[model samples]
Target: MKKVKQFGETVEGYNIPVLNEREIRASAGILYLLMFWSWILVIFKDSYLLLKYANMIFLAEFIIRIFISPRYSPFLVLGRLIVSNQTPEYVGAAQKKFAWAIGLVLSATIFLLLVVLNSDSFINFFVCHTCMIFLFFESSFGICFGCKFYSMFYKEKAHYCPGEICDIKAKQAIQKTSTLQRTVVIVFFAFVIMTVILFNDGFGAKPTSLWLIVKSAFSK
Candidate 1:
């Protein structure tokens, strides 16, 4: 019973329970793609079918992760297989649990609003996007945005963050951003805005079918 109910694994050389950061990130990526696709369907097709199903899946997955062992979660199990070749990067489970608790609440709210209540509102818009942002950071940047709040809620500092972000240390040379790099990024954005302003009409023009164009050219 204890094994089935356990939250994290007790690995060798670790005093506290830990989980594979790689698998967690992989799982986040999977969820993010699912949610993003549902959002696109909602926007382009004006359909809530996919989003409804997505909310149900998201809520159920989080429930399993929090209540049962994460080892049993389907998404995490898939994630484990996807990243099986990579070396495991273990992170403290305590902070992750706190962060995922927030996820559970968000997923539950979305499920209730869209699936159960059969309603739509700005609250749904805001919460859905917020969940995506969290998933995006976790999957893309290895940043756990929700874990940032763990220290605020608890007295003890979070340990073993994804990138050792919890420990205060000097930035490595490679991690430092140069002034030139920052200026280059700003200049690139400026160039992009200028191009958009100059070519808005051309860019917005509808594209013709290549086959139709070819047939017309041959006939002419």
Candidate 2:
């Protein structure tokens, strides 16, 4: 059982030094979704406190993860609890550490620009959007953009990536799908789009401005 340690796993011949890919990705998924909504609040209400303090807390967690240990990270603890029943999907911890290092740097930058300097400017916007992209890819797609730097900066390749994306390409067997199945999937979404676009008038009345924009776009 390897003493049920929270950081890293020994798989095959590789010695990982951090959380498995699944738990980390799941944690990132939760974190990014919350951050995204917080950003939306920033957009509408001009709320910087939520975004600023959240970035600082995010950087602190990554510092614990990268320097102290993943076991001590509160976010990773929540991540583990979230995916307690899922099977482990192991990957190289060194690469993930590299990724989190980038995360720490980005978070620190956001903290400095938004929190300390009070710079409500486009540079802050650009950095925030970039972080969103990184988080979105990792959380939504299980793709680590910063981990891609592992091979370029180091000698070894990251293994057991979420989709085996690091492996060399192999020919895949083709399977034919019926046109009826495709039609069903397409029709389902088409129905949903029409329902929202055609029937929904003002989108809950309070957020009428957003709905007005959508209505105007569709009208044009």
Candidate 3:
């Protein structure tokens, strides 16, 4: 799969990697959606009293990854695993560092959003609704709302280095997965969103701030 460079220089094939800014954002978006579901359980029959604890687990993971995960260690991880260890791609490594930094910030924001605004109504109205709108706009117009805002922070941001792969590979993986994996992925996200919506509604107006199902002893 050797190919000529833009400058007409000969180069060997690059192992196509799946990650880039868009895919990274999309994954963070999915994780935030999952956080929405975790909060939903807290708002429901109080069955998920552990929702708060779940945040603790994630916080611990982040701390460990930052301090202990070799995959995240400066000279040991990420690109070294993907691209050859001998010539670890600096571009890929830099992109991963940026992505991880953004993930940490996003994760902290989500944790605060859940802890401070435990109300299901707030999560549905602000987090879920806003993210859904952003995602739809991105998918429809090929515009990255976050990238635009992120660019405002730095002068050369617009000309920033995207990960190793070109636009073609990024879009392909972002758009498609194997059929069965797609089905499962679609169903999983749909279920999370619907569960958040339904449970939010059911718990929003309850006097005890909870919902319960009455079951006959013999039914089970």
Compare the candidates by TM-score and give the number of the best one: 1
Superposed model 3: Cα runs more than 4 Å off? 1-33, 47-50, 60-103, 109-146, 158-220
Question: Model 2, residue 202: what's the lDDT?
Answer: 55
Q: TM-scores for all candidates?
A: 0.94, 0.74, 0.35
Global lDDT scores for all candidate models:
0.94, 0.79, 0.45
The candidate that wins on lDDT is: 1
lDDT of 2 by residue, 115-177 (tens): 888888888888888888988899788889988987899887786666778888864745456
TM-score ranking from best candidate downward: 1, 2, 3
The stretch of ten residues in a row with the least summed lDDT in candidate 2 is: 1-10
Q: What digit string (tens of lDDT, one per residue) describes model 3 on residues 1-220?
A: 2221111112244333222334333433444555557658756865444555555544554454444442333323232433342432222222343334453554465567665665444543454345445545433443445544544555643323343222334455766678899899999999999998889876676454222333443356
lDDT of 3 at 43: 63
- lDDT tens digits, residues 1-220, model 1? 9989988899999888999999999999999999999999999999999999999999999999999879999999999999999999999999999999999999999888888899999999999999999999999999998889999999998878899999999999999999999999999999999999999998999988999999999999
Candidate 1 has which clashing residue pairs, if any?
none
Error of 1 at 176 (Å): 0.7
